[model samples]
Target: MSRVLRTPDARFEGLKDFPYAAHHLEVGEGLRLAYVDEGPRDAPVVLLMHGEPTWSYLYRHIIAALQDRFRVVAPDLIGFGRSDKLPEEAYYSYERHVAWMREWLERLDLRDVTLFCQDWGGLIGLRLVAALPERFARVIAANTGLPTGTGMSEGFRAWLEFSQSVPVFPVGMIVNGGAARELESAEIAAYDAPFPDESYKAAARVFPRLVPVTPEHASVAENGAAWCALERFDKPFLTAFSDRDPVTNGGERIFQARVPGTRGQPHVTLPGGHFLQEDCPDEIARLIADFAG
Candidate 1:
């Protein structure tokens, strides 16, 4: 584990109650990527990738439920949760994020993966799948989108603006925004646990800005390439988004329209805000298992 994962917040020490066993894969160059490698190591793998402001911790319930039948490997994307954070903005870019995760995957040598991505997880993970389709067998995306933003709604625009302009890094508010209801005190603290102060929050604070909200944004060309690749992605694909999330409503339509194997699979609208897993983990887990079947 890198020194960066060891935060001043001791509250996460109690997170051992979660079923997945922790492991660190040195993705090289002082980067010790933290992941929960659970269930049988030989079981077919499902790679769960999280989005902005959240870590692999977001998938705790899903991990517990699926680890018994499937090998669950969920990594804290460099800078978000237990992974190392680069205090410098220069280190965090869409291209850089893609490359960094490419290295992370190379270290694991994961094959025949079923990708489970939400929020920015879908953004990054999908690009990875497009880049190396052979490594992944299937994909399930929730409350997430490719974010070409060419055909996105005005609501998304307003939210993008608000996220960038917000002065304080309101981790609690953002997490609670997608939550089905008010968060418990402990859960709120868990979201707030990674940061000792503003310094440790560079990644959380920068995530919203990293999203390509407009057609001309910096990540546009890269996502365009990924989309072109996805157009021909012939593997099983599914979308499980929240009905109430205005930010991503109809986003799945793009995937269904574009991706090859997404034609007949179940695409459901789960109940909750942005963070559907926190609100309704049981349904999400069952749906994912059913997808696996």
Candidate 2:
């Protein structure tokens, strides 16, 4: 059995601009995934998935903006935010992340979901869409991809090197570095809140390496299979990639080229960095609202 670590409740106190109440779902034995579910339960479900080194707090502004019109559900992927964390990096893997989320989704019985995924959120969320395409109504992929062991970009290569070589994993600073604008102290602190110490950071530290950037990478075959599903996903798939994100700047081209759903969609380039949620929350919310409608 894997040992789990949960951040103290005290650490999340007084977070800036994040006022949503947390709800939990038991995903595995003794493992509870944390999420923020807002708006009317009967409303159209909008699932927001966050990416590396960030949590549901990344979607606070987006949630607030869309809650009035949609059922906004944002979950902190295991090892981030209020969710349970594994101390050992060996406990984390691309397949395991997908399994945990699959369980969470099944338990929630969320159907006809409109997914908004970024970063690793896209990596994992796209896989979920591929696995259960029937459950999703549409998709809004931003700053995320489902790599099938293809070569990575120069920016991603540098990020992989830095993540592996950096002695102290600074979660908040990493997030700020990915944003187009500087973040406030409290906002930075909220990014750092879920991680009380280095021990709570194994998943964050391991996520970059988990990206299947080379043919030898573990999830290459699985992502390839997912791509087969995505190719047939003839739903309204929109690519809302950001302009300034070096890591995934032109990444949307692949989806547009391959996914049948990209045909006739008004794909766009938003103004932000890698973490566009922090840089353009309201715009993202508006984009999602219009797209889901």
TM-score of every model versus the real structure? 0.92, 0.99
lDDT of each: 0.80, 0.94
Residue 186 displacement in candidate 2 (angstroms): 0.5
lDDT of 1 by residue, 1-293 (tens): 22354454354667633545457776546776678888788888889899888888888889989989998889888777777676655466777778778888877898889888998898899999989999999999888887664655666667667777887777766788768788776777677766666766777767777778677667888888899999999889998888888788778887888999898887888888888878888898898778776
Tens digit per residue, CA lDDT, model 2, 1-293: 58889999889888999988889998867698999999999999999999999999999999999999999999999999999999999888999999999999989999989999999999999999999998999999999989888799999999999999999999999999999999999999999999988999999999999999999999999999999999999999999999999999799999999999999999989999999999999899999999999
lDDT, residue 80, model 1: 72
Clashing pairs in 2: none
Best candidate, lDDT-wise?
2
